[model samples]
Structure formats: C-alpha cells, structure tokens
Target chain A: MKNEWPLWEVFIRGQHGLSHRHFGSLHAPDAEMAIKNARDVYTRRNEGVSIWVVEAVNVSASSPEDKGAFYEPSNSKVYRHPTFFDIPDEVGSM
Target chain B: MDKDLFQYLLRLGDNTLVLGHRVSEWCGHAPVLEEDIALANTALDLIGQTQLWLGLAAEVEGAGRDADKLAMLRDIWGFRNLLLVELPNGDFGRTLMRQFLFDAWQVINLGRLMKSSDPRVAEIAAKASKEAAYHVERSADTVVGLGDGTAESHARMQAALEYLWPYVGEMFVGDDVDAALVAAGVVPDPASLREEYDAFVGRIFATATLEMPESRFTHKGGKNGAFHTEHLGHMLCSMQWLQRAYPGASW
Candidate 1:
C-alpha cells in the first residue's frame, strides 16, 4: 500500500467575497478529500464560511533571493500607507 | 421523576459514554492525522452529550448518584448502552462501521428525541442532534469511500459490516423502560425508527457496493442490563480505575 498521500494547501474564507487566507497544509488523496481534511483540521472551531484546497505542487512561489526584488521595491512607497491620507471630519471612524 | 425516566436516561447516556470511550481509544492510533483529530472531536461530542444525559439521569434518580458516579462507578450490570458500542475497536474499517451504524440511528433518534415531552431531555436531544448529524455524515462518507475504494479496502469494509451487523438489533429492541417513555411521549417508539435506519444504511451500502451479511440473526441484551459481551467489563476496568482507586479525588 502507498503510504504517502499528496500534499495540499488550505485556504479559508472568513466571510463572503473575502480572500481565502492560507492557513497551513495537509496530506490528502485528492482535491475533494483535501477539502474534507481541511474542514477537520482548520475549521473545527466554526472558523470559515468557505474553504478552498489546492495541490501544493501546483502552486508557484518566488525564490528567497528574489524577496528584495519582489517586495523591497514597494517598501520605499510610503504613500501607499493609509497613514498618508488625511480624512475629513465627516469621514468619521474611517 | 419516575424510575422509568431515570433508566431511560441511563440507556441514552451510557451509549454515549461507552462509545466516546471507544472512539477516544483511537486518539493516537488513527490511520491519518486528519482522522485522529476527527475521531477525537467526535468523541468529545459524545462525552458532552453523555454529561447532559447523565446529569438529568442523576436528578431523576434523586438518590444522590451524580453523573460522574453513575459513569465511573457502575458495574457491568448497571450499564444500559447497546452492545454495538462496547465491542472493541477492531480496525479502522470496523471502527467506522460501528460509528456509521450508531450515528445513523442517533441522528434519527435524536431528531425525534429533541421534541421529547420532557423538556430537559428535549433540550439535550436538540443539541446532540446537531453533532450527531455531522458524525453520521462524516462516517457515512468514509464508509462509502472505503467500501468502494481499492480491493483491499473494499474487502475490509465488507468484513467489518459482516462482523458488526449482528449487534445492531439491541439498539431498537425496546424494553419496559422504553415502553413507558414511548407511552409518555417522552420518546418515539424504537420500532418507528427501524425503517428509516434500514433505508439510510441500505442507501450507503448500495453506494459502497458492499453486500449485506447473510446472517439475519440480530443479538439482543445490552439495553436490559441483563447481558454484556466480555469487552464491556475490560473497558470499564481501565475507564473506572481512577475514580475507583482515589474515591473522589478531583483536580
């Protein structure tokens, strides 16, 4: 019998239209079962309204050496920070 | 509170308590990590349901025996769970088979029990039915998946069904306690649930492509407190050791 099951990445949507945030990974035979395993492992506490499971192999990640090229360029763009915005008094709490 | 209600609560609570113990036994031994957590969660739900049933049972008994005492101190003859639960966890296949059988019965049982004439029992049943629904769904999925899976898995599942099928009769054989409760509208008649249970199990078996066992002989005795398989005594020995040894040492 084969001992190793395929690996999957779990994503959970906390609310409607919310981006599914990556929680962690687990091993399952297929995508449908990955969803079931994700339910058991990640959402036992009534945490998610929806779940998406993708094969870990199918995902592509940037290299650790490319971190500076990918993210550091955005670090100097301080205008992207919400702190730069001045809200009128009428925009209460925003 | 009548002795009949107390006895009925025992039958209900004992089933949860004993099977919770059996499921908990698989804490570290499940085939996969996901299943390990799933079984533990399932066991927790049963034990929680047991607390509700046993607490009510103690109040109805009114003899000062509380839930812990009833659960931890009882001898074999005092228990009223069905024989199906007490059977040892044979394999992954057998464990799921036992779970599917009981969860199927309980989903229907609790559905009816939630509307019990006795409000406390009804409240507990309402809460338990939600959890039992998940148990039945998860277990039934596993049963069908494995039964229709690889050749080895199919064979094992078929064997498990064969071994456990005979013990299911005791679950629905209403004794005097059940008769009184049914008459009081505190519960539905056990006979009423039989067809639904059969249909549910049959539908799953059909999907699994597994054949029903030929032996139609269904064993009975657990609900009456008159008979138990050897497994129950051994289970009680380890389960009761703490309370029996310390005699009420609490954390």
Candidate 2:
C-alpha cells in the first residue's frame, strides 16, 4: 500500500554487556512505535536486555557487485587471526 | 470461606480473562502485522494475569474448580468483569481506547493492591502492576497519537473516546464488597480512585487534543453480577465452546 507504515530494523542485546544483534524488522508509524513493536515481536521470550530500532530506509547496504571489495578481501588475511598468539602458563586461560 | 474475597477475586480474574479474549480476537485481524503481534502480546499478558488471579480465587473458594474451569465453564451471570471490558471491540482505535481506559484504572488499582493486607493479593498485584503500567503507557501514547494525528484518525479516536467514556465509571464505583475489603485493608475503596483516574485521564485527553465527554452519566451493574451487556454472553459461547464440546480437553 502507498501509505504503509515505514519498516524498521530491530537489534536486540541479549545481556548487559553484549552487543546488539539484528533480530528482524517490522513496520511502525514512528521510532517510538517501532521500539514498542520490536519489544513485542522480538523480546517476548526474555530474548533481550535492550533494543534498538533503525529505519530501513536509513540503512546503507553494500551492493552484490561490491561483495569482493567489501568482504572477500578479509578471507585471505591469516595474520589478522588472533589464534596464533601463545599465552604463558601463569596467564592461565587467557 | 470469605465470600466477599472470592467475589472480588472473580472480579479481578474475570476482567483479565474477558478482556484478554477480546484482545485475542484481533490475532490475525489487526490492521497490520506489527500491531497484530503487539495486540496479541497484550492479550497474552492479560491472560497470564488471569491465571494468577483466578487460581487464587479457586483456592479461596475451596472448590474443585480451577482457573480453567472458572474461566471456561461459567455462564454470563457468573462473570464479575466490568462492563467496559466485556463490550465488543468496535475497531482498532476503539479497542485501544477501551484498553487505555481499562489500563489507566488497572495501573492505579494494581498499585494500591501491591500493599494489600493479603499477602497473596499483594504478590499478584506486584507482578500484574508491572504489566499494567506498560499497557497504560503504550495505550495512552497511541491514544494521543491517533487523537492528534490526521483529521480522519483524530476524528475516529475522538469518537472512540466518547463511546468508551461512560463505561469508565463502572471501574470506580464502590459498594459493600469494597467496604469489607477496605475495612480489612485488602483493597482500597474503588470510589477513592476517582480523583487520580480523572487527573491521569484528563492530562492524557489534553495532550491527545480530544475533548472529554461532558456528561457524567454511567451505566453500571457488570462488576456486581447484577447484569451485563449482551456482548459477554456471545463472547463466552465462542470462548467456552471448545471445552464445552470436549469436556476437560487439553493440549
């Protein structure tokens, strides 16, 4: 419909220190209603400690043609892996 | 047995049970998907509260009937919900308007109940109060938004407010039952809640830019079990049909 409510992307933080992860999207008339809708749609099962909603129109996405530039380059960077580091016995599980 | 307390708990449980069912009727029929989910969530919260309230009521009655039995097996006169709650959900705006009116009263009533002399009553009130507070906030915000929005929405919300206004009084009309509860400190007199309800609703109406109806006339009798609007009987037929058809059925 031409007058449909705007779509909003929802992000939910599962715990106090956790970063919010994208959960889903829903339509709302405004930012406030978007948050309320996200709470109802995403957090009913104790799924989140917090929520964030962004308008779908305001999100910037990389195009499929730019996938190599945006993502493929990172696949070959073995030096970027933190797994190569060794810890002293005194440093324990770190 | 405390007959007055049992009656009061039925009033509490039945309000949530009936209103929850009414809200659930919008499950797949709301104006939009998000709203459908939101309304369903509201209904679920009310139904959860119903379980608590009615469970306690059943215990107080010392009868074999449980919450499910009290909720599903009861006839119209057995219900003690406010007439406001049992009224049909006219439209989306009207449903929310009815919700707002009920939630406003419930938030205050539950707030007072948190300090009830009956410990079980206090415990249920504490949990239900949180949900009622959230319900009133969302419903009030929607009322203001729709009441002050485009001409069409504003007009519809105004009409909704007018239609639901008279029913609001039934929530605060105290009688002998309230007197006994008040004497025992189990509940505050319903009449005492009027000033706060008016102030809260007045501020909301002012912000919504919707005029409150000037008339003070109220239709009563639902909560006392003296009478109910025809809507409650029709609602029970659908709600109770499954249990009626297959007695003691459960999933």
| Number of the top-ranking candidate, with TM-score as the measure | 2
Question: Which candidate tops lDDT?
Answer: 2
Tens digits of lDDT, candidate 2, B1-251? 28899999999999999999999999999988988988999999999999999999999998888999999999999999999999999989999999999999999999999999999999999999999988998999999989988899999999998999999889889989888989999998998998999999999999999998988789999999999999999999999999999999999
lDDT: worst 10-residue window of model 2 chain B: B1-10
lDDT of 1 by residue, B112-193 (tens): 9988999998999999998998899889989998999999999999999999999987777787778888989999999889
Cα lDDT tens digits, model 2, A20-87, are 99999999989999999888889989999999999999999889999888998999998898888786
Worst 10 residues of 1 chain B by lDDT: B212-221
Q: What TM-score does prediction 2 earn? A: 0.95
RMSD of 2: 1.7
Candidate 1 chain A has its poorest 10 consecutive residues by lDDT at A28-37
Model 1 lDDT vs. the true structure?
0.91
Count the clashes in each prediction: 0, 0
